[model samples]
Target: MTKTAEAGAAPARGARAVPRSVWALGFVSMFMDISSEMVHALLPIYMVAVLGTSVLAVGLIEGIAEATASIVKVFSGALSDRIGKRKLLAVVGYGLGALTKPVFPLAGALEWLVGARFVDRIGKGIRGAPRDALVADVTPPALRGAAYGLRQTLDTIGAFTGPLLAMGLMWWTANNYRLVFWLAVIPAFVAVAVLVFCVREPTLPAAARPPKLPLRRSELVRLGAPYWRVVGIGLVFTLARFSEAFLILRAEPAGLAPMWAPAVLVVMGLAYALSAYPAGVLSDRRPRLDVLLVGLALLVAADLVLAFAPGLVGLGVGVALWGLHMGFTQGLFNALIADSAPAELRGTAFGVFHLLTGLALLLASVIAGALWDAVGFQGTFVCGAVLAALTAAGLLVLRRKA
Candidate 1:
């Protein structure tokens, strides 16, 4: 079948259907990312300089947010399947998060800021997996790469713009964090509106899909024995992959100034944005495993560069490589999960995938931070390099067997 025909065809196994309206869902993500990155990029500054939150507290906060989001994802997806309304849930998630943005400006105490972050994360956890399932539902297996890449590209573009806008706002306002935060609310609201009016929910198979049995009892295991192996490989790869906070930390130690960190990120994001569409196209043409393995290798090289080399040049190379990997892997990940799993359980699968990766990232970041304190940057990269190398090897072995 042609790609378009394939997209409109029925899911192989009575999976709940996705509507064509689902395709434009990327706009929602795009707007959300813009709003999110704006706040996230500035949050450390606000917390440390303004609220005096310690590094440990920041880490704790991150862990809590990610773990909460990751764990809740499966439930929400399953619930959406049960309820037969991805649009409603998507609206709820986006709306709730947008509503929480004002809290940052309203927060006078450290506890209040934490509460705001928690609320925002709560919204994210609620909506994420269901959203992915919607994308999968509407598009066919062949189109999965394109759909996800389009979504990610939109999202990454937001990431790129949000920080730049925040910087401009800060410059305009003379670095008034409160004013900038309040302004963020505007975009958040716009995003909620887009999801509400613009995006349509995918159509589900008519018999009213049943709720997924909880974690241990999921029928998804029918995908087979080797399914678990892929999950394990994913987990190991995630362990080596830490937070991008490390990127900021690394760049500064190189010739990049601390204040210029966002600019560096912008550069990296631009690279990521440029490469994503082609990577997605590649995933569409070949096995997702190959594309994703290529991304891992690029990441490994980036880590190695971060460990050695001269000032600005080394930092640029590392950041660029990281961008390439991000481009390659993120979109390909969706393609892989889509290709490998039954459509009925897509949301649940993505939820599990994100949860594992998020948890791993949280742990890796903490460990890298501790390593930085004790063994310094060199030790940290050495460890990351080893993990990345192992990840690349594992991916290759998996491909060979395939």
Candidate 2:
């Protein structure tokens, strides 16, 4: 980084603890994730017992939601640069998501459930890139990995808490799913309130910002070769990996208890939380190739565990490993985008990355659903394991090519 770039990063730096604004941003993510995961963690039960939803429906909702977030990311990120405010949009996104929380509690039909999901994802799409861009805006270059890691750590912590909360509610209410969902609104409201008051965005150069309008030559815009390769890794990996919801859904058919749902999810979230920040800090010096390789290998091993695991203990191990691998790479993957892509295009890069990855997830889930219907849980996982291996193999090829 140049002297000027170093100067540009000054605002992001504060006292050793990280600025109150940034930590608050982490809180916002923490609480919102808690809210979303509360419902998402237990959704499998609601679908299975309450609505009698099929695997295909479960897959479709997630696939659709991710696809929605992707589209919003492309334009909203660009728009934020013009508005010169990442913080406000983030608050709006959080607020929107919170507002929709009540819908699930009121929903009586699966379609309404899907509709609530859509509204919530719309909030996600609006907030994601701008929020990330805001973090970059305020964070010093040297702390980039640590900052993103901390943010990811907090986010996954919410994932951990949300499920445990859900589990408790389920047990306490004697399986009153609706009441548990109603309680989700509290954390979400807290997240939005935090964002509104505390998080701050530092003003920076437009080049250092996400673009305000359509990119001058978007398709032709250079996303550096190394970054492009990183995106490829994400895409292939996403193709192999289905959503966590699907994983939980898959476990159910194996006779896993609904009450045990939150426990497994808690384990996965803990694995993700423990690894994300360290992975980010490590990625700063360790070379993405090396860290990425280790992560891919871990995922391959995870898939193998899932493919062959005959019971709950084995299944838990596989899920936990999968979460660990994801934590190791998830935030690092975004940091890689920041490193390799130009500042003006960071949002585009992320959006494009999500587009490909989300689309792949959509396809993977849908395809997995069909396979599950045809051949059952084990068969679907056997296929997933093969695909994960293929994704790992692709990474090795990229390493050699680079």
Best by lDDT: 2
Model 2, C-alpha of 368: deviation from truth (Å): 1.6
- Return the TM-score for each candidate structure: 0.90, 0.92
lDDT of 2: 0.78
Model 2 lDDT tens row, 283-343: 7667777787778777877878877777887888988898898887888877777777666
Q: What digit string (tens of lDDT, one per residue) describes model 1 on residues 1-402?
A: 112343666543211233345435767787887888777777865676577765555655776677777777767876776676777887888899999999888888988887888888878978888888777776877567777777777778887788777777877888888888888888888888888888766566744354556244556665445556666777898777676656766765786643456666676777788788678877878777888888888888988888887699888888888888899988777777767766656666777777777788778777776777777777777798899898888778877987
Q: Which ten-residue region of model 1 has the weakest summed lDDT? A: 11-20
Who wins the TM-score comparison?
2
Q: How much lDDT does each candidate structure score?
A: 0.74, 0.78
